[model samples]
Target chain A: MQLISAACWSTYRIFVAYILSLAFGIFYGVSANVSPKREKFMIALLDVLQSVPILGFFPVAIAFFAAVFQGQRIGLELAAIFLIFTSQAWNIAFGVYETIKTLPREFGEVSKAFNFGPDFTVRRVYLPAMIPTIVFNSGVSMANGWYFLMASEIISLGNKQVKLPGLGSTMMSYLAQGNIWGVIASIGTIVLINALLQIFIFRPLVRWSELFQYNATGSAPEWPTVVDVLSGLGRALRIDTFLVSLVSLGNRAYGKVAKYVIYGIGTIVAAAVGYLLYWLFTPPYPWDILVQIPTALTVTAMRVIAAVVISVLLALPFVIRSVRNVQTAQNIYSLASILGSIPAVIFYPPIVALGGRSYMELLSILLLLTGSFWYALFNMSKGAMLLPGVLTEMSQVFNIKGWLYYKNVLIPAILPPLITGALTAWGGAWNASIVAEHVQFGDQVYSIPGIGSLLTEATSNTKALVLTVLCMTVLIVLVNMLFWRPWYSRSAEKYNITE
Target chain B: MALLDIKNLNLTFRENGKELTVLENINFSLNEGEFLCLVGPSGSGKSTILRIVSGILNQYTGEVLYKDQPNPQPNPNVSMVFQSFALIPWLTVQENIELVLEARGINPRQRVRTALKYIDMVGLDSFEDAYPRELSGGMKQRVGIARALAVEPEILLMDEPFSALDVLTAADLREQVVNLWQEKKLPLKSVLMVTHNMEEAVFLADRIIVLSARPAHIMGEVSVDLPRPRDSRDKAFEDILDKVYSMILSSRLGK
Candidate 1:
């Protein structure tokens, strides 16, 4: 009966958390993608968010949320939702950004040439392009959310420990009490339910979207009513289609108004820049939290460097191998995708078992680091594969091999992908560290002294503190300035093959 | 006297549960310094013959004898310039040429020197550090030529190298190629090229071998008696071009 109740609560939390995170993710991701200037900043922010684990943010989330609604009883739910939101937001945003940036130019040009305008473009073009990518990210993010669901529900700060009677809280309670059977049963039940949900719900959605892939090859398959519903919405809005038709009608009636179209774009750009600048100056929290920025900035710098070094080490060999041989390269991709989908927590049990979770908790930390490493590897390999076969043949004909080959050809070939992956993985490591630092096995708890552990302690004691919020904001800015800026500038200067 | 010899070459490609023969019982031989043009209708295995002779393709029944010795496999001794100016876009003109030197473990300064010499040789010295994408189509082909030259190959095989260029550029590139061939004839001992343009074939080739339609065999061989630095408008060149063009067109109709 308890298990049944626990299952119900877990389901409810996962569903609510997934939906909220996915929504915020899509909004940020899509917006950043369309606005090229915003993309770097948004992606940097996401990287910092992803790198810091869910448990680490709980303290600040609780503190801020609790202060706003001092007497409110739904603080626990809000905290849970926010944790899921941050966990998924970065990934979803990344998915959106990646999809948008990679969308076929021909498709975009074709839409524009036909005078589809903004409304028709978003409905018929952008949304359709984003669906498959969005779904993939959502599935991956839900898996990420589950890793910390147990930690998120039970708030512990110094003397105040609150269990919200959800599956997460129940699992924590069972684990704390050394209930072996209960932990096993919970993990098993969660996995089974999730697998079933995937097979029944998500897989079919993914398969359905494969029909759209044919459009790129000029042989679009029958898409069913989804496209119709979107087209209908576009028509009802009469925004892009209506405005464009009106413009076309005017062009026929009175010959040309390109200035008005240009003015509309100018206005949109002005509004976006104004909004971004405002956000940059405004602190999400009070002035007191802003004072703690320097320490947080230093910590973030250390973390970003550590993540980059670790992830590159893991990704480099695989990338080189993939570039040298095509068949092995494909296999490497499949391996990365499988590993990428699995949550970082799966490594925790073996890590704690093997390494005792000390500062030299080398194995666990490596595993934690690899959660991001695999992501970098996947993107790097894909980018390397994109190097034109003709270019490769030229390299071979010229006999460019080994270090020179990598330095002159392969490095330049995959630099953009490498930087992008490194940033994304840096974000992933931040999130993974939260779960990695805090390990509970057989009535013994071990934690490393970092933001992850601090967050865990803050949440455990239910101390509504602004520590996490302050740390995250500082980390985001520092990452952009210290890492992404130099990298992005270098990429822009080096790889701009404007044909 | 033969620099390269093909002994009874037969090529087949397997697709969708059936083996399709593209080249059947092909035979040819060429002496040192001779320019050979393998011409036929598209899909008559002209490119396949270059690929096989260059050792790019090995799934065939044939012996490509190099200096009276059968070529075993693809190697650097034979270099091919693809129809698509296969220049590595990321590398600069100098770096692209230096790649072969690097792979061969030549000293960095010496490699740069040699690469620069070749870049200058191809008249791209000013654009030595420019990327392939930044260069014109003709310039990219020059880089391709320089890259092949840097390898110090015994036989130079070109697969419709001028096809992707504009007519004026193609003519200009052809003139530059013949001049280079006259000037530095050591590395490129013999040239075997595939061309759809009959004029290009007639102007460059000593002997133009035409293949029959698919399951391609030697249909005929036309020897170009035109002198060195041959004019495209020369009666002999035009007559050979007309004959080869009709043969290719008639072969297509036959297919």
Candidate 2:
């Protein structure tokens, strides 16, 4: 009974967070693409925000919400939701923005030719065009939501901890009590929920969204009977029509005041950043905390590199096998998607128990691997699958085998997605470092010297926490701009295959 | 009065800090009950002229007049068929037609009726519920035609309508288009088509306008006075075809 209730609470939190993320994602995406001028600023801002680890927002969430609500339950709930929002919203918004940015010119012409108003165009054209992207990204966003939901439900700031009544806190309490059976049961429930969500919701959604794809070739796959029944129910209830009307109404209202709202938001964001800068540079600053940032960043960067390297090594075999066999590729994709959704936090207690203090470094790497490895595997497999068949045939005809084949053909073929995956894994490893570098079990606390550990340790001091987050954000964004972006685009340009 | 008129239409594009003139003083007219074709070399801004008349492009000098009025905005009486057959892939043939009708505030029942009528007119009688991706290139263009016609427009602008299709399909669609015009099966008063194919223009057009290469200006216009179902092998048809070809080629050579 306790487990069931806890599961419900956890599910409720995830559902609410997902809804909020979807709304903000569509709004942000549309706003970003409203004009070229806004696109530059909005895209750059999103890039910076996306690089910041989800945990980096914890201090700000607590500082604002906890202060505003005066440590009430509502404040912590909102903080938890905000943390999940940070985890899920960025990629979704990016997906929507990209869909809008790349929409075919003829569709826009058709809309204009038909004299579609803003509301009608959005309802019929823009929204439909974005549906496929939104649906695909929703699955990834939900997975991220789960990971952060587990991390956020049991928030710890120095000695003070606020635990919410969810599966995450339930599992934490079970571990604290050394109730192995209880922890296993909670994990079982989580796995069950993930399976149910995949089977009932996301699978049908993916199938349905295929209809919305432009230039979609070949016949669509058959959907399950449940989808038919659900669609029938929706039709009977006039749900689709109701939703379309709602969008039209909302867009009409938004169109009237969107300009002023954008300006208001710009002013508010500027003021907030100005205030944050002012607070950071005030006299009697935490110079000691500032001094630790460089070394801590170096340590975390090394670990992130190690994590990405290990993930690449581990994922290469699977990628090769999956590429060679279609059946194996499909199986691997399904299994990875399911396994990848399981949060790495679930394994923390077990690793802590086994390793204690001596194996902290090894266990940290293991946890980081769990967090980062799937991105490499998924992307590399996708890249390999997308390899033009003629290249392989050419290699066979030319008798290019063994190391020669891998070096010249395979390596170049997968280079773009490989780089993409590695970049994402790099970011994932950095985010995982927060939970990986520091582990707390009951009365014992295990720590490593890294930016993550520094940030976690400074949670009690809002100023120190803010400063560490800022430093990490700056470092990550700089690395992405200076290194990853250039490499990614270069590889994409060089290795692009046209069929 | 001309059904549609373009007077000194000029378009220039600013790219990489350099001003590139795309169209220079293009002039043409489409009369009621006439099939007009604009023939030119590829990238000679022939399709750009169609886009202007369709109201998809408006940043140009001079004016586009419908019924001798200064029409600058998109007119509901003007409908277009695209080279790529821009049917919304998600919507079925029926729904794609209805979408335009819906936008024009046609009631649901009337939308279905008008959409079906055009769908049947294009001989897509049983493919009402089929999405664009499911149809062949020819069928998709048929849907595009049906969609444009369902609006009951006075002017039809086709931008290389059959260029994306296989040769046999393009021939069949061209015949069907001529049939539709000759049989008065649609509410269309005039059609202005843009194509680079001299043979295609001779086969279907009542009048052909030849354009020069980039920074395009009208080189000349050829009027076809052939009988119904004009054969490409007929002497008159080939003569007009030769005339259009020479006009385009001579302009290319700065003659």
Candidate 3:
């Protein structure tokens, strides 16, 4: 019963946050596109915010919202929703903005000649244009959000944990009690809920929104039963026109002054980030334990770099095979993902039984591969399969064969999605490292001296967790600024198809 | 008296704080039952002048009077056909027409009744339920024309409406447009079309206004005196096409 209510609360919280995020993301995205200045600063700001890991801010959110709502349940719920918003909103905003920016020049003239008002444009133009991308990104964001959901539901500040009623808390408690079956049950529940959300929400939406895609081709799949019922409800209620009227009203409300109001929002967010930085450096409460976060970060960074290199080397053959025979590769990919989801911790006991003949760091590296490597395998194979037929034929036509063909013709073609997959895979490894570097399976332990272990040990103290997480965040910001941003821009400039 | 009139039109666009005039010294008027074609070389701003007249563009020094009234903002009655068709793909053909009716504050049931006539006129009666993506290029332009005609505008503005189509499709769509005009089935009176096809202008237009290269001004005007179902092989039609060809070519060199 407690589990049920927790699930309900999670659903309600997501619903509220989803609607608000979708609205604001789409609005701000279109605004950024249409606004004369292009809002490049605003776009950069969103990118930086996305790198600030949600779990890292638990101490700040819990303390701030707990006080603001006077220690209320609603306050904690709001805090969790805000954390989910951080994961969910940015890509949706970027997706909408990018879609709007890519709209044909004639569409702009059509809008002008037709005199499409802000309200009509939102309903008829922007909303329709962005829905496909928004649906896709939401699926991705939801997957990431579940990882943070586990961290958020049970906020452990100085070991005085405030447990929320959710699958996340249920899983945590079950895991702590060493009841593997109960943890499995909770995992099953979460997966079932996620599947239901996908089938009813994403599948139907993804299918429906495909019509709005600029390069839309082929027949759309049949609508799910949920869509049929919903469309019936909509028709009975005359919902489409009614929603248009409502949106236009909202549009009229924001007329002329919307940009200034948006500017005010950007300022508030900048100030909030500054304040959080200040608090992180000078925590009001001191930690009992000392954590050498910089050293830990370096240790983890080296491990991550190694994991990324190894994964690419191993995953390359599969991608190459997929480039030849796409059908078999698709089958292999789906099968592999299903097998991969069986957690690495499940096999830790057997691996540990083999003893010090194999290195402990190798065990952690293997565990990291379980969590991160599959993303690259899946994305790279898909990317390779999608390589244009003409590209391959042209290589043959030009007498380019063997490794030379792959090096000159294929490598640059697959680089964009390959890089994207690696970036996300590295991020997943960073998150999974908190578990990967230290493993406890069936009374057996295999530990490594890395930032994950540092974070795990710091969990017992409030200030240390905050300070350590803050240090990791600062390191991330620096890496993104000096390395990732430049690499991403350059890769896109060189390899990405312009038209 | 003219159905629509423009005088002393001058337009400039600022890029990196540098002002470049796009159109200048544009003067023209449309009579109640005339088909006017504005033809020129690419980048000659014939489309800009049309955009200015339709009230879609406001940053210009000009007199754009509709029936001699100086009203600004997009004139609801001044509808346009775009080169790309520009149909909202998410909406069905029927709903696309109904959307205009709804904007005009027509009742729901009545909107369907009014939309059907234009859809039938465009010969898309069977395709009212189809989306734009499902339609052919020629069929999509029919929707674009139907949509413009749906508003019951006094004058229609087409900005290179047939440029994106293949030669065969363009020819078919052109005949249908001239058929609609000749049959006098619709409320529309005059059309101000933007095109670069010298032959097409001679074929469809009552008066072809040739524009000079950018900072575009009226360079020459030729009035086609040929009858309906114009034959390109006829000496009279050939002469008209030849004259339009020279006017546009000379202007291109004059730039």
RMSD of each: 21.3, 3.1, 4.7
State the lDDT of candidate 3 residue by residue for B155-209, as single tens digits: 8999999999999999999999998877777778889999988989998999999
Compared with the true structure, what per-residue lDDT tens digits does model 3 show for residues A66-93? 8899778888887878876775677577
Look at candidate 1 and tell me the lDDT of residue A109. 35
Q: lDDT tens digits, residues A170-248, model 1?
A: 7666766768688677766677666766665555554445443312221223444554665578578864454334323
| Colliding pairs, model 3 | A6-A165
lDDT of 2 by residue, A447-491 (tens): 889998898778767789888988898998999999988998798
Task: Judge the docking of candidate 2 as incorrect, acceptable, medium or high.
Answer: medium
For model 1, the docking class works out as: incorrect
At residue A484, candidate 1 shows an lDDT of 75
lDDT of 2 by residue, B32-148 (tens): 999999999899998888777777787889888889888747888899999989889888889999999999999999999999999999999999988888899999999999999
Candidate 2 at A230: error in angstroms?
6.2
Tally clashing residue pairs in candidate 3.
1
Q: Report the C-alpha displacement of residue A221, candidate 1, in angstroms.
A: 9.1
DockQ of 1: 0.01
Residue pairs with backbone atoms closer than 3 Å in model 2 (clashes):
none
Ranking by TM-score: 2, 3, 1
